[model samples]
Target: MNQEFIDHIKALIKNKAQSQLKDELQKLHPADIAELLNDLSYTEAKDIYRLLDNEIAADVLVEMDEDIRKDFLELLPSATIAKRFIDHMDTDDAVDLMRDLDTEKQSEILSHIDDVEQAGNIVDLLKYDEHTAGGLMATEMVKVNENLSMPECLKEMRAQAEELDEIHYVYVVDDDDRLQGVFPLKKVITSPSVSKVKHVMKKDPISVKVDTPLDEVAQIIEKYDLVALPVVDSIGRLAGIITVDDVMDEIREQAEKDYQLASGLSQDVETDDNLFKQTKARLPWLLIGMIGGMGNSILIEGFESTLTTEMSYYIPLIGGTGGNVGTQSSALVVQGLANSSLDSKETVKQVSKEAVVALVNATIISMLVYIFNFFRFGPTAIITYSVSLSLFSVVMFASIFGTLVPMTLERLKIDPAIATGPFISITNDIVGMMFYMMLTRLLS
Candidate 1:
């Protein structure tokens, strides 16, 4: 949010000419207002919102947090709002808003909506789950027939330009409305006037179905460095296009989900989400960890009798090594999987590479510890070797667990990021503690 722009909006709201404020706000882009809306309080945002036309407000509203948006909707009289603003919104944006609305509110809004076509589009979009490609795509796209000449295509585009928002790609379709191919606008413009779209356009355009997952869509866009990707139906008919901007949102949403899941919370946990709801989301993981800890305790208590001698003092050494190695491996594996780069071949390679690196560090560190033990406590070579071996094993185990757990989660269709910190830490702590104590009994 730009502070200067926010200040300008604030000053405008303070002035007497509330009527003129809408015209001034229209000058700013919807993205700018969306940014500013996030920065403002609900009340302050409502004031700024009322000044804008319904279309602008609806666009900005879709970008806002769920709680604040609900509050803003209530602030306005129900009759003053119409479905046209929402009608102007893309299918994805409309679905998001509809999903957040209360059952009664949703029914009321839909009933009041005059445009049957737009309302039906929203309903169609709402059928898909939120994370799917159908839920992310906008139905507003420019499509032209492959048979159209340059002059005919230009005239059609000029007429349709007002209806479409994201116009980076002009899709070439057949009589059946099936996507034949697509090319850059530059190609369309530079081609000879007599060249048919079919002759000029590249066939076999890379495309995705409407039901594809958001992360997969993001991956395709990123991999191809696309400005826009066409969304198609199961039969490969053109559905819509998801612009680069929406892909950016999907990336941010996925990143936030990864962060939340890594901390053992649901993807919906946001700053605006209620405390009790957030607490409930995390409590399950903490309880599971506690259960694991207690189970670990029972096992460790069995070794309480054997920790009576020289080895008791060295227990911490093994635990520390295991914890560090496990954490390092988990981080690498988690990142690899999250970015869709981790596979069995890569995992094997990564595990091998990481194992070598960890072993080298562990060997050097254990040698240093052994040297210190010799000078500080006059330990025998056997005792030093035992400790070194225990530490090395712990390090190796930690690295293996860290690399494998995330990969396993990915195989199960769970996010690999969730395996990074808390899950890694808990497993490492339990394994490290148990292994160190178990090894100590043998070494002693």
Candidate 2:
């Protein structure tokens, strides 16, 4: 991560000093190695990747940016990718990596994977909707039958723990494999060995169905402060476990996606993406904004006869105020929805609160603008009263419109984030112009 270390690595790569590069890479963490790979050309990165052992390479692959990892994966054969990387990766991570590949490539990679069980688990995971708990869950977890004694449970846990990197909880299941309870890791040392697992374990454990949405899964984990959450099938059978680390990744990805949507991007994009990709992601929103601008011009043209030079000077102020207010309202609504702080049922309550806030803001802003206009024009001037009234109306309308649009979208099962930024601003701008022109004409 340091500049000097990066410069040294680049020099070693340039000089083709394989021994030094291997020694240096071994000293760094997988995530740090991934950061270095991101800064290097694909060929240079691949050279460094080849020096890593299979386990570290798998970890490094997971840590790299998706676009870079995709390109890197393409350079390797299915056999090497499967036997070397996928075999060493967690089920959820393997599914994530495989999802980016074509069907044929996925099949080939599966075929080459040495562990039949792992390949099967990946295939099963791929069947779930990518946005759900099942897709994020991994089969790697420690579980024991509820009938086992504490000593027996501990023995079984030891065997299962060998296959896992870390053990968060020991799940207890019935004869039917239905999840009955959770065996706390602390109980292993504290509890007496005479008791059965079912008696010793905490009964009625909190869990999620496989079909639960990824966002809800994140909320559950966060709310419970869990390091892992159990996933259940329709029959209440324990299917897999979702680790906190994976849930954290899901949370980050969702936040990034929402942020992109709020910014008016049509798709996920990064600065390193190709020109065409970047253009494609940005152009749709830009075109929409342009259309909105043209529409505003036409609206102004329609009201041309009513607008005196003084009246026309206030148009920008009205539109800009409305757009700024709308954007702020929509952003708050979108963030509240994302974090589960705002419920669809609370729409009326939220809008009412927003209206009160808007009223305060509108009153202050309109009063300030009116005072300035009254001093500049005569107090009796139509422009003064009309402009002030229009500002007040536009602020109230923009705030209410912004709050309701996103909440309505969410109610309709649409992503509310799309209603933020440009969409809200454009809508508020056009409507603000109409309010100003209509109020002015009537007042005059």
Candidate 3:
């Protein structure tokens, strides 16, 4: 959004010039409107929102950041929210919005929704845990009975197409509504010479169960290069469909969350969040890093008698090098796990591979540091050999430690992202200090 346009809207809002503000809003996209809302105060947002038509309001609401949308939605009445926004959203989006509200608020909003089928679908979807395939799938889809004739299937498709805004794929189901196959759109138009839908449909389609984890669903879709995947019940009955767009949106959200974790935030947070919330999300890791710093100091104090003053000068180099090596190893492991390129079962293979890479990295780094120190201080000085050996030991140990932590976390069903950033850096800093001091003592 243009800064001039936003300032103009603000001025119009301040002046209470509703007519001109509405006209200008009409010229902007829903995403632009959403961005403007995020930048405005509650009263100003509400004023600008009132000028939008129900459909556009719904679109803007969806486009807004979840934090901004949740705060904005709370100020609206249940009936106003239901009629003006939820009614226009897809069932999946509706579920997402509803999840933000309390059960009582959700019930009140659902009661205000005019479409009984849409309301029922949202209710059924709410029964699912939010991180599963069922919660992400939409009840809206076109399906034909496997036993239907070509003409019958076409009629069914025409009738169903009337309800949906867009169609990704046509599904074929048995008498029990158990998913059987996918009926291609091209096959539908050409009216393939087959007698029944069963003969023409592509059987044994790729799919996931309703309770499948969101990660598994994303991987299956990406692996198959599918635009959409059918969701099935425990008994193999078709429940809903997951379109790739929805999956992509979820993947983006998860990526943001993981990025935040890697940056040391303990919880979900946004820039729009108030001071307390932002502090709460950030303080835990900062405190942990502080403790790790204290621990490193105590280690140095304990080894002070054995450590030379010159060795202290090289502590920063060793600690920083260790942290960098650890961070790189954990990041690669996390990325591999996310893309399914590295199997959790293959932890030994991954660690073994990382060790070989670390050996090469450790050798190169130690040699470079040794040569630098050799030129600065004579090769006979114990400090020269101590710092170089410490660098080599720290690099190898940090690399192996970083790789092991995330792999263990993955096997234990913990988010591997926590293994990055402060967690790895703090740990490596303390351990690297210990390595430098011990190697210095031995060489002395």
Candidate 4:
């Protein structure tokens, strides 16, 4: 991604120098080629793509952003796509590309694919839900029967490893293809060749069912520090394997989705998205904030006669403080839920802990404001007591309200992230105004 390399590629593309372009592409990694393509126009990108070897082309296709890849694929013929990219890609990557196409297009691509086994694997993967372990697993792992000797196992592995790009672990299966153990790659060189594979293999290997959720699969891989995890059918037969790279992609996507929701976006969106798409994702939360502002205005107007100009000056402070406190509380709850550190069952404990923290914060903030107002307005002034008291009450209420809302959302099987940012801030602003007006009236 250096400027000099990019400029060289751009110059070659501009001159229509296919020979130089192919030479430069061969020296760059597939990901770097993808980055160059992203910076180019459709025609320019197509030219660069055509220069890549089939294996590199397949890798570059996977590295491209999903939106860009879809448009790129549409410009190519089905036969070319199948023969050049799909045939060389891993089963998981092929399934991902197929998921983006229509049924007719998928069928056409599958028919054009030269490898029958790869096509069959893609079709079987397409049958599973996209958010499950089956959808994330690949049929490229090396497995051997437990009854085979070490020499026999190594021979079988050589044949299987030829088709795969990387080998992390060798699985040992029984006569029924049931996953029984895992044999480490290092054992092939270190262990005695006279022994059967089962004797050297570690028994009771860790694995997930094909029906397991993607989130749980990610957690297992992360917890065990595994390079790859095995997937099994209900009957304990080996189905496929999910690599660490695939789990990393899922984790990154989930993090981005949560960040978007917390920022008040209704859907996944990028800066390069069209104006209509950007507006649609942002408008709902903006409308909610508008309604909340109107509600606060009405609440203030109801107490207009009870307040002097001095009291009116403190309205912004009350609303802004509450909003800040509420946003902080909701953000913490959302993050805890996402990282699995907070459980819905422990809602009471979390709220209680938040209350203690809020109490200390409320007392310090209220006292500082009270001291400042007391010097300006004198000890007997209604503005002094009412502003400070309203602040204390608002802080306590906002903190508890924010903590409870997200936790309740999680308990109800809803995404808790939506309760953060603008949603909590707007709700707290309206409630804070109501509290300020009520406290002033009662004190006066």
Go through the candidates in order and give each one's C-alpha lDDT. Answer: 0.75, 0.92, 0.91, 0.91
- Candidate 3 vs. true structure, TM-score: 0.96
Candidate 1 pairs with clashing backbones: none
Tell me the lDDT of candidate 2.
0.92
The candidate that wins on TM-score is: 2
Candidate 4 lDDT tens digits, 1-444 = 878877878888899999988888888888888888887889888888778789999999998888889988887789999999998999999999988888988999999988898899999999998889999899999999999998999999999999999999999999999999999888888889998999999999999999998888988888899999999999999999999999889889988988898898999998988999999999999998898888888888888888789988988899999989998999999888877788888999999999999999999999999999999999999889999999999999999999999999999989888888688899888888888889899988
Off by over 4 Å in 4: 2-7
RMSD of each: 3.3, 1.2, 1.7, 1.6
Tens digit of lDDT per residue, candidate 3, span 256-374?
Answer: 99999999999999886899999999999999989999999999999979777677788889889999999999999999999989988898999999999999999998999899889
Model 1, span 94-162: residue lDDT tens: 777778767677777777778888778877777777788888788887888999988788777778788
Q: Which ten residues in a row have the lowest lDDT in candidate 4?
A: 1-10
Each model's backbone clash number: 0, 0, 0, 0
Residue range 380-440, candidate 2, lDDT tens digits: 9999899899999999999999999999999999999898868998999999999999998
